[model samples]
Target: MDQNFSIVSLVLGASTVVQFVLALLMAVSLASWTVIFRKYFAIKSARLKTNDFEQEFWSGTSLNDLYQAAINSARQGSPLQRIFASGMREFLKLRERHLDSTTLVDGSRRAMRAAFQREMDAIEANLSFLASVASVSPYVGLFGTVWGIMHAFVGLSNLQQVTLATVAPGIAEALVATAIGLFAAIPAVIAYNFFARDIDRLSIRFDSFTEEFSNILQRQVAPHPGQGAAAPSAGPSTRPMGAH
Candidate 1:
């Protein structure tokens, strides 16, 4: 069993550096797989939650009611819910201070923008590492292969029994490192591209939602006569006689 499992037999006469390279490739592959699975679930859950929240939001629900619901279900929080809460809270704060419509909209927009950036940051975490692994692993593997080939030639120079059979095994073993590197890299590259596209789509959705919500608030603050504006409109008929 030991003879069958010797380095020369198992690795086809690979050098120590070549074996190390293969091990490194395997480790990177395992790490990338773990990240892929984790991000897969995370993105899926985020998308589902975002979709659910958007449905509830556009169903004529009250903003305060939706915010309360989101707070109550914080464990299932979505980016859209968080952004809505931030914007609404800011708008309410400005309303409480008796600020004008422009100020209120500005404050709420700022809050929503901040919330959007925060949510994006959370969604994009660890993606850079995955991307780096994808882009660099192949080159790393090729370096290992070059080193292995150099070592093989050096070994042949010292040995008098060099032949086609003797050199072929070492070269084959070195090529294995490159193959393993590519195996680790390809899926990581594909997954990174997929996740990046999904993130961009989500970002666009968030931006559009922010704009729509802002428009809703603007209309609310500037309602027609007898409508429920936060503050009464100033007019000769509606204002007190002594008012400025």
Candidate 2:
């Protein structure tokens, strides 16, 4: 509480090991914040783009038209768009070979699944680092605190007359390491949980889309009564993915 006992002085006066711990914690905290912000915007943009694409897709737009648009906008395509493009491309190619409904649907589903995995991997990149920081930083800081306390006690052992004033600074400086560690950990924990939930929701969305699109493909490929092989519908079908 003394004016001379500011945080800056406490950190500066900390032992070398504690100082190193603080520095490491600070660097980790900075990196975590960077990931947090980047992931936040990335996920937000994905969700928004997905909604937009879904709306367009369900607006009775033609499948061929959608596929063409997807191809033209490949660089700006969202995860959903890429998944749709992959499935549609595979379906069209296999349909040309006169494959049965099951084979057509299965091939398209596989393509979609592969695209889904790739997108999920990209979305989850660097997420493990946040998890690590959240789970391990506290222990790292604790190690520094323990080391600083031992060093303080070793210094006190040589004193002829140890007093509260002599011990307070050492203990305070040591506790700062723990504080820094918690500071680094709490945000990473919260961010990791939030990003995890968001990513899970996106995964579910992708899964649902995959199933719904597969059904549509199946319907198109399946033989109709009294009619030979049906061609792919030029316009979008009546069925939707599902309600959100």
Write down the lDDT of every candidate, Cα atoms only: 0.81, 0.90
Best by lDDT: 2
Model 2, residue 2: displacement in angstroms? 2.6
- Tell me the deviation in Å of residue 132 in model 2: 0.5
Candidate 1 segments exceeding 4 Å error: 1-13, 223-228, 231-244
The candidate that wins on TM-score is 2
Instruction: Give the clashing residue pairs of candidate 2, or none.
Output: none
Instruction: Evaluate model 2: give its TM-score.
Output: 0.95
Candidate 2 residue lDDT tens string, 158-203: 9999999999888988988999999999999999999999999999
Candidate 1 residue 82 C-alpha distance from true site, Å: 0.8
Residue 187 displacement (Å), model 2: 0.3
